[model samples]
Target chain A: MSEFFSMGGYGSYIWGSYAITAIAMIALLLATLRSLRNSRIERDQLETVLQARRPRRTKKAPKAS
Target chain B: MHRFAKPSVFLKLTDPLLPWLAGATAILIATGLYFALFASPLDYQQGDTVRIMYLHVPAAWMGLFCYVGMAICGAMSLIWKHPLADICARATAPIGATFTALCLITGSLWGEPMWGTWWVWDARLTSMLILLFLYLGYIALVNAFDDPERGSKAGSALALVGAINVPIVKFSVDWWNTLHQPASIVRMDGPSVDPSMQLPLALMILGFTCYYFVLLILRVRLELNERRIRALQLSGMFDERSDQEAEKANSYDAGHNAEASQ
Candidate 1:
């Protein structure tokens, strides 16, 4: 109801605090997730590249047979 | 503890706990918000304006909590040269800064209506502002250097020194004739707050704590992955000279100078 929104005439202050807190928390969470995802992608890419470059067989391979 | 400090082990231990922590954070915050806005009664004195305490107090508490965590991690990294501790300290700075800023801003919003002023040079407010600056300074100092190890060393030193302000912030109201009210929930005699008001306050504090751990885990993983990628790239750049070195570095994060720092 409009009465609750008005909050006995201190509506703006109450709502403002809640709104900003919500926004800041959400923003930080998204930023953390985005960076985490990006780093995971980067690490995976490097890993695949390293795998391709590594030797396919060990030094103690099967004798000529 | 030392065995689990290895980056790989740390990640494995924490990754499985992430979903549960995140779920708890979401649930606690939602319930806390409900109680704060609707279920709890308005203050006879301050009316609806008291609702701001739900956000302001928790943010303030978390701001201090994270700072203490950073300082402890700083000591661990300094005394034991724990790379994982260094990563944790670095990951905590931004989150702490965010909460401190939240506390200050919400406090300001509440102040304008209650005190008829938007700004004051009170002890509590000023020290809290200093805490925010400390977080910002730590983040900048840590990332300033090309050598991550050196950055961690300098950053941890700063964190240890800045810890003096946490106690000052906690006791500022009692120590001075500040406009800020004295502690109500945490006191020698026990919480003076009403049981209903305490419900939202306690829930929000727990929720914020859960949120911090969830982010700490994510950010620590990010830092570890970045370190591994750095080691991998360094090896890849000089692949022709020593193929064996590259292979060694490719053993995941083992290339991060896992020192025998006993």
Candidate 2:
């Protein structure tokens, strides 16, 4: 276990490369997901506002029986 | 092909694909890591430090691939004026930049231990650095203008221009004496590395490719949604402006009626 972690004395270099790659990829994924969520929220809000502003249609009254 | 260029259709088509792509990426990466760390034998030359190649090489490849993808999208946007192409190019910039950054940082990390230096301004390294700058420049140019269309146009042109660096980065080692080694896997003579190493490398490349697509689809969706919101706001502004005009006209008529009665 310790030997595996040590990586024959080049452990720091190997681990550093992997760690940075992992961090960058995760960061990008999170940022992309967050942006998607935010955009969806904004779109929904705008759509709702537009729907509310639209003029409501009226129904005609029935003739006297 | 052109049919999917519509943002609405694009969103519909890619919505179903994201889950599969993400799942494949996760599986591939896990397998690749397993193979890289445990199964692959130590290099007789570099020892365990060669493990860095698994991540470093794939990232460098992806950085180049993404730039090429961006350039193609830029061309489509510029020449044919494909609507989604610009958005795709825009979506690709940041992702490519990140990949390029990863490549550089990992390369540096690998270099420090192997070459006994942190960095060298060699042909390959310098060209890759230029690629990173190109990605940054495209991102900045795309958002610099008030008119999004104009910004996209400018960015597309810049991307097209910067594409010359891609080939330079690829062939830099062969063209000049550099601290970085020349191509090993992608040669006419075939890959020089052991089969064990190649498997993990291939898996890592595929995994990274999957991740790129997943992010690209998400970013493109966000771009489309943002555009929709902008259009909605603009329409709403137009509606409000017309309403104000109608109100002003009504007041003017009311005043005229009152004066005539007086």
Candidate 3:
């Protein structure tokens, strides 16, 4: 087990490479997912507001076909 | 290909594919890691340190892969004025930059123990650094303009220009007398790597490619939604009638898409 970890004295380099790769990949994924979610939420909110305002009619409003 | 320029059509096709691509990415990466760490044999020359090649090689490949994909998308955007292509080019930049950075970092780590130095101005290394800068420059240029259309145009130009470096980076080792070793996996003859080692490398490369697609899909969708929000903001409705207001908004959305695509 220890031999596997030390990797014949090159453990730090090997482990560091793998660890950083994992972190960077995960970070990019999370950030992209978060941006996607935020944009989706913002668009939905704007569309909802637009929808609510769409039904609003003035007293003198003409019938819209 | 031109039909894919429609955001609705693109989204409809890709939305169903996201889950499946993400699943493939996870499975491939997990299995690759297993092979890389435990299943593969150590290099007689470098000992266990060759494991670094598993991550390093894949990251480098992705860096180049994303750049080529971006360049192709940029060309399509320029020739066809497809907003989807522009969005794809924009989406690919940061991911490409991240992979390039990973390549440099992992190479540095591997180099310290093997090459006895932390840095070098070797042909391959220097060109890779340039590739990272190119990605950064594209990101900055696209966002620098106030108008998205102008930004996309300027960015497409830069991407097309920087594409000359792709071939240069690929052949830098062959062209120069550098300390960096010549190509082992991709040669005119064939891959010179051992079969056991090849398994991990191939798996990791495929895993990384799938991961790229997953991120690409999400980012493209994000850009499409943002475009809609912008169009909605620009086409504020003053119509009092409910039906007309809805109609006006839909028309504005359609007009915005049509103007760019035309």
Candidate 4:
């Protein structure tokens, strides 16, 4: 509603507070997710290298007389 | 439950959850802010200043909620050594502190017009301020020690001590006559607030809760991976040493065979 945005005259202060809070929350969320993604990628790389280094097992043959 | 505490399992479970939680948080916050800002009716008495309550109240609630959450996780970390518990406590601290900070700032913003001043040393505000300090102290103590385990144990003790402050913060208005209004939104009898205003308030609270969960899950995921990386680093070192030993043993065996052949 037009009246809602007008806020009967205190709109700036009230909405300002909400805006700042929301922005802060969003920033925190983004930072957290970004770092999490980086860590996950790093871990995956480590796991892959470790796996590659592991020796592959092969079956051995036996001869009968 | 304890089995899920394994880092690999936690990482896999959280892998899918991270994006979902983040998406949920964004939707909740956008809708909540829309409702809070555009849909809700202005207060009859306090007019627009009452809008400040949307951020202040939910943030205050989360400030308390987060500390309680941290305390429980810290206790679990200390007793059972739940690998994720200490990390949870660590991750939640900054978010809690931010909410507490928001509460104080918005409380000041609300007070300036309504109370004719920015702050008063009233019971409610005083207790809430102390709660903020408690959060900061816990965060500082937890990171002070060189050893992670030592820091965690010490932080756990601080968190337990700080839990006592939560009740004091909640009940301070009732325990004493104060400039701050008593519980208007959450009460045994029912919220004294208008229904029009209540809806937006409820939305904001839900949004804030979702935001907290989003952050918690993301942070915990990072922490679990960090632990895994640490383990991997140690394993890498062990692998290098084992490889060197194997190479040395093979060289020694080859030399012995060659000597026999000669």
TM-score, candidate 4, is 0.82
Which digits, one per residue and each the tens of the lDDT, describe model 3 over residues B1-262?
4355567798889989999999999999999999999999999999999999999999999999999999999999999998788999999999999999999999999999999998999999999999999999999999999898999999999999999999988999999998888999889999999999999999999999999999999888888888888876664444333435667778888999999899
TM per model?
0.89, 0.91, 0.89, 0.82
In Å, residue A45's CA in model 1 sits off its true spot by: 0.6
Candidate 4, lDDT over the whole model:
0.82
> Candidate 3 regions off by >4 Å?
A57-65, B1-6, B237-262
Name the better of 3 and 4 by lDDT: 3
Model 1 chain A: ten consecutive residues of lowest lDDT: A56-65
C-alpha RMSD over true interface residues, each candidate? 0.7, 0.7, 0.8, 1.3
Chain A TM-score of each model, in the order shown?
0.81, 0.81, 0.82, 0.70
lDDT tens digits by residue: candidate 2, A39-64: 99999998888777765311111221
Q: Give the Å error, residue B1, model 4.
A: 12
Q: Estimate, for each residue in B87-199, the C-alpha lDDT of model 1 and write its tens digit.
A: 89999999999999999999999999999998899999999999999999999999999998899899999999999999999999999999999999889999999998999
The 10-residue segment with the lowest total lDDT in model 2 chain B: B1-10
How well does model 3 score by local distance difference test?
Answer: 0.91
Candidate ranking (DockQ, best to worst): 1, 3, 2, 4
